[model samples]
Target: MTLMASDTSADVVIVGTGVVGCLVAERALDAGLSVLMLEAGPRVDRWRIVENYRNLPPSMRLFHWDAPYPPKPWAPHLETRVAKESEQYLQLEGPNARAYLQGYVRYAGGATWHWAGICWRLTPEDMRLKSLYGVGRDWPFGHDVLEPYYTAAEYAIGVCGPSDPALQWPPNAERSKPYPMGPIPFGPGEKRLTEAAARIGMMNLPAPQARNSGVSYHGRPPCCGNNNCFPVCPIAAKYDAATALPKIEAKGGKILANAVVYRVETGEKNAVEAVHYFDPNKVSHRVTAKLFVIACNGIETPKLLLLSKDDRNPNGVANSSDQVGRNMMDQPKLFAEVELAEPLWTGVGPVQSSSILNTTQGEFRNRYAGAMFRMENFARSPLGSAAALKKGLVGKALDTEIRRLSACTARLTVEHEPLPLPINRLTLSSKTDWLGINKPNIYYDVSDYVRRSAKEYTVPRLQQLASELGATSFQLSPEFLNSDHIMGGCIMGSEAATAVVDADCRAHDHQNLFLPGGGAMPSGTASNSTLTMAALALKAADAITAQLKHG
Candidate 1:
């Protein structure tokens, strides 16, 4: 990517260089508009990240996945695993504090660098939660409205899904076009779970993923089952936003890293006049643009908006509705660690390849939350080695113990869909970062809807799976955990008084400013939300292009 210049004027200034902003920048540049993207974090090389992860300390490698990319002094993300209040960049408190301990990083690519590559699209029922299930807010439009954009996002991101429509996530995804590549074959462990789940009347389908299966697409190679997709991908097979930066720059889009945007300057009629940011050295810089889009994830996006307040907009930039940071949501999750009678042998493919999706949608949503389950495919060598070393085992004995433990152990996860609660809010913390900006303070609770499902619907189903898998030892986590699929905070709706953004993700308070991605999602189903976020980004790009061309 080209260097950032002193001249920062552009037609559009996007506040985060994650996939959302990168896609928006690409579309605006394609429309011949001058695009400038300001990223809070520093630009990093992919190879460098891979090497850093490879050489990290054993403890850090096992526990601290974000250790590879240390946070910049100004662009700090939630770093410390410790629950100490003083050490947190994102101050989380509620009935479920552990549930909100997110693992996102402040790097050039955003969180996708450490993702499992799963890409599940939302079903029609997922969008119309209020109308169909009598609970939660519904999307402004239906699945038919988002179908084309979903197709476009899948092709742009090079998604691979099952060839058989019956095996698709939405029971034959309503696709205008087929997947770019067929599904990756499941490993022995995945196949075993698929078969067992089927006998129990559950459909465990192959997951639609972004990484390639056997052929190359858009210059990236196919996955070779490296099984270390958590910290780094090692190779450029999986999709990451960092890979999109150079292409955006090649098309005349300017990206400024280490530029921590703190204020959104508004002028007459609440139009976005400019945005001001502080560099790592704490020197502030301001840039003017005709329009602005804040594509920082759910947490950071709301934090940035709350920081930008003026006499005309006292509550915050888009607080005319007082909804900038309300309605925080996530797919609250639980894990079940099981040991089988015989070796199950996970880690034969990507970190995740299939899931039991039948539970994600049902008529039972009126009572409790719907949940989905998956067996994690992370290689067990590190965990096995740790277990073996603790026993004072040596040499061949150590190797034998590690081998058996890794092969026989498995982790099953239950991710429950959550409702957008007004109480689950993200506000500005009294705590300040190294740049003297207020950190994000979020109060999160999984709520009774999710908890009811865990006790009645999901936990029972998990027990059945463990029984079917012939688990000699079974241990389910006591509390709900964060699936890392953050949503809400800046909710969307038909009324300007209730929602932060409009149907096109444009902020209601400021016509020229758009707030897209996860923060604007009204509902998040029991699946990975990244693909849905990408579809929304492309949709927002269309609106931005239209405004630039005709308005």
Candidate 2:
């Protein structure tokens, strides 16, 4: 399976066969371009797919609370050198230093394989954070420009939700039509919270999701409602990038699995000419193509660019702007749990069914703050829930408390925007991995704005909502203090000095090279990033097609 440098060339070489890469390949094929998609993971076998139920060990499951998790068999060879944990704070150096944060995902479909498909479009204000809120940088393109692309992505991926008429926050764009599928069923906990929020003058509605509730347009079956959406979808109810790879293959694009792209080979003018990768059997291969797209998640994408050092571009490939790996940001999450006076069914549907815009504006807006609270669906397994209950309620009568709290428990999650800081960034370390490439060193710390915003603004609002819902005892989950939604690093902007890609998603230095996914996001909004990432990929695909047609 190892493909060497003498491997066949392609019209377009896509590094990383994730959702974005697959979409890009599909678009390339549509434009009459032959595509070769390189994936570091092995080809997926449907029979080998395991159910992500709570019975499995945390390490095997996604979203587990364990460090030094066992690396997947197909993990990139270059990733072995990544520091496990450093005593001294390691500062990154070099032009692409900012983009070196440690990120995971070596599977063929990437992180989407373990993602919760809570879909929400970035608010219009999100695109112009600097112009409107005087914080963060404005996106080169606004929500208006991405509306059409968003619609296309929605249909392609089969989104489910009703357009909110309230129009708060960034507000969704004018949809070409409604969601391909209907909203997921609201659980009893969501019903109680929704009713309580509405009575207290709060706007609560069914949160838009990418999970299938019924037969979807794409011929995918509805979600089985196993309450396990994070790790793996046993029935493919939730949208994963794997769903799109077949479509790309059907369109004549070739997906080369078990191919780990090590670097982007550039020519005399610093333009990428081919992607250098190693196959499963340690065979080195080079895929020459007219265009190269890097969608290897945020961390690896930047790392690959930095590793592609050449005499012409001494710093790295597409490092002329020195913004390849800067502005690392992850939405820090805060969770608040409330025990309602009346018992409510804890699990009956998707984990998050209803959301409220309690603090989307006002003083929080001026501080570049994110949303305050949303009614999260409690989909934790019995074991995990038992662990949560034990942590929050500590008393002699533990058994009695667990029995009483099982039916009435409810949790709300607050997603706050992390302020992009230069010091908290990614860089290449001296440590070398099996591939002989330096490991990606990540340094991340939540900003004061994020900490203060969650404690001062969000926590209070959540408490007040719980009080209004006639809750007896309210406790916040300590585990939620650190956010899971990771973004930034390789952000898109108008200038090469400030951003990695242009508004069109083309690398500033190399016109034919593109980088998509969370890395391209200028700012991580309150909503889930997968939808936005897919939308941006569609937009980039269109731009690439136009350029190919014109040239």
Candidate 3:
């Protein structure tokens, strides 16, 4: 619902209605503080997105998940499917330009609307990268500090995974409690891959997913194996932020959709007083609050900070260290398509049910990056059918080829952790969107650390795994694809000179402002970074609660 003029002032003003923002709002409202959320995209419903998918042409439907959730012209996001289209938003530069065309939907819910729902927590060692690995910076605190918050985030998002410690993703990290729901059973493909990985002395664990498993939890339904978790979940079995908006409203929180936040206005003592946003018709509105937060993902959060320059902070708000839009990161992934000799039946469960955790850490990280390998559990029928038809095979021949490829084809991906580099960054582009807001331009390259991991560690291991599966052909990707876990633009550290935010994700330069999300992550571990981002949000929420109470 749109916020009225009287609702302008709040205890907390959150920019972005994504999962991170929604969680923060939930906690702050739970503390009896009023919250006003500003979202750039329109409020959309599940049925509308499902119908949009159904209305697409067969070819477009096969590979174009982004087509269903078309971005509002005023709030455009990255779309790789049609990179040359009118609303190609994210401006890419550097040699690895095309690789950064991330597919995150800009709607009321944000990217969680289309995520695979795999939630992997960061390991204790992952937090202390500098002390242990000597590669990247360490977090201000360790896993023990964030473990309780991780448990809270899992329950908040309705995550289900194996209770067995041996079956956990980071098999070494101690768990305070079991997952919210029972583990999802392994499918035939996951079972086969697990066996194959075992032969190579690796561990394949059932991935912790935010989707419900057997029974409904937190208002979401159980997973029915619809296999449509990419573009949108047809059922409400998966957790997304859209589901949280109404709950926030019911608790006296206000949300304004199609409210594009442009500038952050500072009042005194390096405090964020108010924010300026534009409506869909380019009508400007200002909302003031005691505290402010920017949770518009990694790219937009940094871009917004850079755009909010003022007299005291001429460089930008909270950018005294020049760390607002620097040290950009994403998990650079390597793809391998194997034509196995046996049928795997991959589409029996969620899009990503399991992953090999053996390569995620070791003493070898000092030289190269860590890798997490997993099976791409998307159904191969439509993809195989489309490819066969395009090759002039029709009727019986097409049917035979489609069945063969669908049953035997298995795609494996290895996600490598790239160290945060100041050179790899995002800047406001000279070009502007329809709203006259400067677009984000990125310069990124997977450093040689990641390349060395692929060459020395992951590639050889993937080949061995493919051979163990008795593959006919194993083809490796020539270039890296993004895991879409954008991170490190507004990095967290103990010192103000080196980091944008502190351990609590509160801006070091502005005590009353917080930038909590993947962008606050200091190191981009090989796992899906959502759980860590959620945990950070919860931690930030507590900090904000304490500040409001004692101050």
Residue 299 of candidate 1: its Cα lDDT? 92
Ranking by lDDT: 3, 1, 2
Query: Per-residue lDDT tens digits of candidate 3, residues 206-308?
Result: 9999999999987888999998898888888989865788888988888888999999998878799999999889989888988999999999999999999
Tell me the spans in candidate 2 whose CA falls farther than 4 Å from its real position: 1-7, 51-70, 73-104, 167-173, 384-403, 477-482
Error of 1 at 385 (Å): 1.6
TM-score of each: 0.97, 0.87, 0.97
Model 2 weakest lDDT span, ten residues long: 62-71
Q: After superposition, how far is residue 324 of candidate 2 from its true place, in Å?
A: 1.5
> What is the TM-score of candidate 1?
0.97
Q: Relative to the true structure, how large is the alpha-carbon lDDT of every model?
A: 0.87, 0.69, 0.88
lDDT-best of 1 and 2: 1
Candidate 1: segments with Cα more than 4 A from true spot: 1-6, 82-85
lDDT, candidate 1, equals 0.87
Superposed model 3: Cα runs more than 4 Å off = 1-6, 80-87
- Which candidate, 1 or 2, would have the higher TM-score against the true structure? 1
What shift in Å separates residue 305 of candidate 1 from its native position after superposition? 0.6
